[model samples]
Target chain A: MAATRALIRRGARDLRLLAVPQCGIQADMLIGAGCVRGIEAAAVTMGELGGAPRFNAAVKAGAIEIRDSTCPAIHTALQASEKGVPFMPLRGILGTDILAHRPDWKVQDNPFAESGDPIVLLPAIRPDIALFHAPRADRAGNVWIGRRRELVTMAHAAARTLVTVEEIVEDDLLADEATAAGTLPGLYVSGVAEAPMGALPLALTEHYGADTDHLGEYARLARSAEGFAEYLQRHVLAQDVAA
Target chain B: MPVTRTELLIATIARLLEGCGHVAVGASSPIPGAGAFLARALGGDEMRVSVLGSRRHNFFTDGGRELFDCAAQGRMDAFFLGGGQIDGEGNINLVGVGDYPTLDVRWPGSFGSAYLYFLVPRVILFREEHSPRVLVPTVDFVSAPGVSEEGVWRRGGPHALLTGRCLFAFDRAARRFRLESAHPGESAESVAEATGFGYDAADPVPETAAPDRRMLDLIRGRVRDEIAETYPAFAAEVLGTAA
Candidate 1:
C-alpha cells in the first residue's frame, strides 16, 4: 500500500495494469487514486472481506477500461511472453463476451486437427515491470517464493521484476537444488527491498497470515467516497501505511 | 432436525457431485467447498476435492495456473461458477450490467469461468440469489457461455444451474435449461415469477430434497471443521454448532 502511495505521489497516471490473475488492495488503491486507465484481471476482489469498493465504483462510473478476463487466459498470455512467443492458443472463451470484447484476441483453426478445431489465441502480455512481495531473499538476490510459482512467471514475463521481502536470509536460495526450484534467480530481478511485513494486510506464504481485522475495517470503511477518503487520509496519505 | 438454508444448498451441490471424481471449488464459495467435502466424505477415497484459498485443501505446487491446466487436460471432473447475470440460453455475465466499457453495475471479473466452463465436464452454475435481477432473459455480457458451438473444441460446458429457489439442468443438445426441481419454500409458479428467463418445466416440479439427518450430522461435524480452514468466518458464523 505504501509503495502504491509512493507511485501515486510520483504522479503515475493512466497506468495500465495486468493483475496476474487476482488482486485485492493493490487494484482497489490504484482505482481509488485514479491512476489506473485500464485493468485486465481475472478478478479484483477482497475475497471473503467482500467486493473491492473502489474498483467497483470506478467501473460503474466508466472511469477506466476493463479488459475482463479469466485466470488461465492471463497465465497463458504471460507464459507466451516469457517463452518469447507472439501468442499462445488456449481453449474456451470462444463464445463469451470476454473474447468478443477483445478484438486483439483471435480464433484460429487448430493446425494439428484432422478437420478443424477453432481455438482462442491470446496475445503475449509483456509488462514493463512485475512487482510482488515475498517472504525471503538472499544476499545473492535469489528470492524464495516457495510453491507460489505465479511470481516466477510474472518475473520471467516482465522486462523488470521488482520485489520486497520480509527478510534477507544468509543462505543462498538457489544453492540447493530443492530450494532453487522455488527461488526466483536474480537474473530476472531488477530491484529488491527488505521491508519487514511487506505484505501486511495480505499474507506472505510462510511469514504471516492476513490481518483480517484490518482488512475487514478497510472493507467496511471503503464502501463510500467520504469513508474511502477518510481511510486514505488515515492510512495511505497521513502515515506510512505499508499494508 | 430441520436443515438450514445454507446446509440445504451444500447438500444440493453435493448431490450435483455424485459421480465427480475431482471437484474444484473456487474462492469465496463456502457452500460449494462444503458440498465438495461432503461428496468426498460420502464417496470415500475415490473423490478428490480442492478448495481454492485453503492452504490445507488445494494440493497444487506448480502455480496459480495448475487448476486451469488440470481442467484443460480433462483431469478436473467438476467446477462451480456463479454470475451477476445468468440468462435463459445459459450465458453467464460476471462483467456487469449496461453497455461494454461503460457499465452501470460491475461485479467481479470472470475468474477462470471462461476457461473452466469449457474444459470441466460438470460446470454447475451456483448463484444463490434467485431473482429477476439475476436470472435475466439475456445477460449484458457473456463472461462464459453455458454452451459453445460445435467444432469449437470444447471438452465440456454447463451441466446445471443451481440457485436458492430452484435447480435447472442444462440441455446441451437443445441449448436451453430444463427446470429440474424447486426448493422447499418455492413452488413452480413462484420460481417462474422470480425468474426472468424462459425454460421448459416439468409438469410437477419435484421439491429439492433437504439434507437428511446423517448428511446434516456430517455437515455440522466434519464438513464444518474442514471448511473452517478455508472460510473461518463462514464456519464460525453459519456452521458453528452450539455444543
Candidate 2:
C-alpha cells in the first residue's frame, strides 16, 4: 500500500477504488485518509483482524458512494475490459437487490439460449491505474506474483499498472519457464518502484507474514476517526519505510 | 472430551457436508474452514476443501475467479454464506440497513453470494448470531434472494440455514424455512423469541447433536492446527491454540 501512502503524503483525494473482490487494511487506510470518494467491488472487512472501521464509518456517515457488488461480478467486469468487450454475461444475480442498485449492470435474455434464459451483464471495468505490492521484480520490471493471476488480469485490464516490490532481482524473472507462467510481463507495467517491506503489516505470500501485532493495534486505533487520523499521522505519514 | 460450542458448530458443518465432493469457503470463515478440514480428514481423497486465502489449504492456481468458474462448471458442490440480515424467505442482506445510498448501517457488501448461491447446490447459510435484528421478518435489501422465480435458470440456492440457536431447512417448492433442530439449551420458544422471521417448527424441535468425541478430538488437534495457518487469532481464541 505504498501507493496509498504516497497518495496520503501528496494529499490525494476523491479517487475511486475497487476492492478487487475483497479489501482489508489497505483499503481501510485509504478510506480513512479520505482518498476514496467511491468504491466498486465486493466486501470490505479486515478479514480475521476485525471490522474495517473506516469503511464501516464511511458507509454509516454517507461519506462515500458504495457500489454494492459480489466477487465474481467484479472479476467478470475486469475480464470484459481485458477482452475489450462492452460487457460480460454472468449467471445468478437474478431477483437480487444488488442488481436493483447497480444502474450500469443490465439483465437481458441470452441470445444463445431459447426464450426465458436471462443473465446479468456487467460493464467493463478499465481502471486508470492498478497498483499492488509484490515480493520482487526483475530489471525488465517483470514481476513474479507466483500463482496470484488476479494481478495479471488487473494489469491486462487497466490503463496503467504500477508495482512496488521488496527488491529488484538480478535474474530475469520470465527467463525461467517455471516463473514465466506467473510473471506479469513488464510490457503491461507502467512503472516499478522498489520499496522494501512495502507490504508491511500485510502478508506477502511466501515472503513474510503480516505483522498482526501491529495490525491488531491498527484495528484498535482505527475504530474512531481521531484514532485513525493519529494512526495516519504516526504510522503512515510520519514514519519512514524502515519504521 | 468436553465439546465446546465452536467444536459443536464445526462438527455440525462437517455433518452437513457429508455428500459434497468439494466445498469452497470464503473470507472470515474459520469455523467453516475448520469444519471443511475435518470433513476432508474423515472423507479421504475424494473430498476436497479450498479455504480461499490459504496457500497451505487452497489448491487453485488460476487466482480469485477460479472458485466462481469452478462453481459455474459444477465442480464445486457447496459453499457457506452469512449476512447482516437474513429473512424468512431465505433472502440475505449483506449490503446494509435503511435507505440505499444513505444507509443507517452498512455491512461490507455482498461477496460471492450473488453468483455462488445459484451455482453451488448445497448453499448453507451459517450465522452465529440468532437475534431478531439479524433473523428479520424481511431483509432491508437482498444481497442474494433465497429463492428465484421459476423461470430463472438457477442450479441451486438455500439448502439450509444454521444459526446459533437452531437450524432451518429451506424447501424450494414451498419457498419457506422449516425449523430442523435447536442448539443445546435452546428450545423452540427461545428460537422463536430471538427470531423475527416466522418459520414452521416441529412439535418438538430436536436438540442439535453434540460433537462426537472423535470429531472434537480432530477439531482440537488437526483442524485447529490447519486453521491456525490462516486464522491464527481465531484458532487461539476458539480452539485454544495460543500455546
Question: Highest DockQ among the candidates is held by which one?
Answer: 1
Q: Give the Cα error of residue A214 in candidate 2, in Å.
A: 2.2
DockQ of each: 0.82, 0.80
lDDT of 1 at A38: 92
What would the per-residue lDDT of candidate 1 be over residues B63-164, giving only the tens digit for each residue? 999999999888999999999999998898987889877677777788998888889999999999999999999999889888777677787889999999
Question: Candidate 2: lDDT over CA atoms?
Answer: 0.88
Interface RMSD of each: 1.0, 1.1
User: Looking at candidate 2, what is the lDDT of residue B83?
Assistant: 92
Q: State the lDDT of candidate 1 residue by residue for A62-137, as single tens digits.
A: 7888888889999999999999999999988888888878888998889998888988899999999899888889
Per-residue lDDT of candidate 2, residues A163-210 (tens digit): 999999999998899989889999999999998888888878888888
Instruction: For candidate 1, give the lDDT of residue A189.
Output: 90
* TM-score, model 2 to reference: 0.96
Residue A77, model 2, lDDT: 93
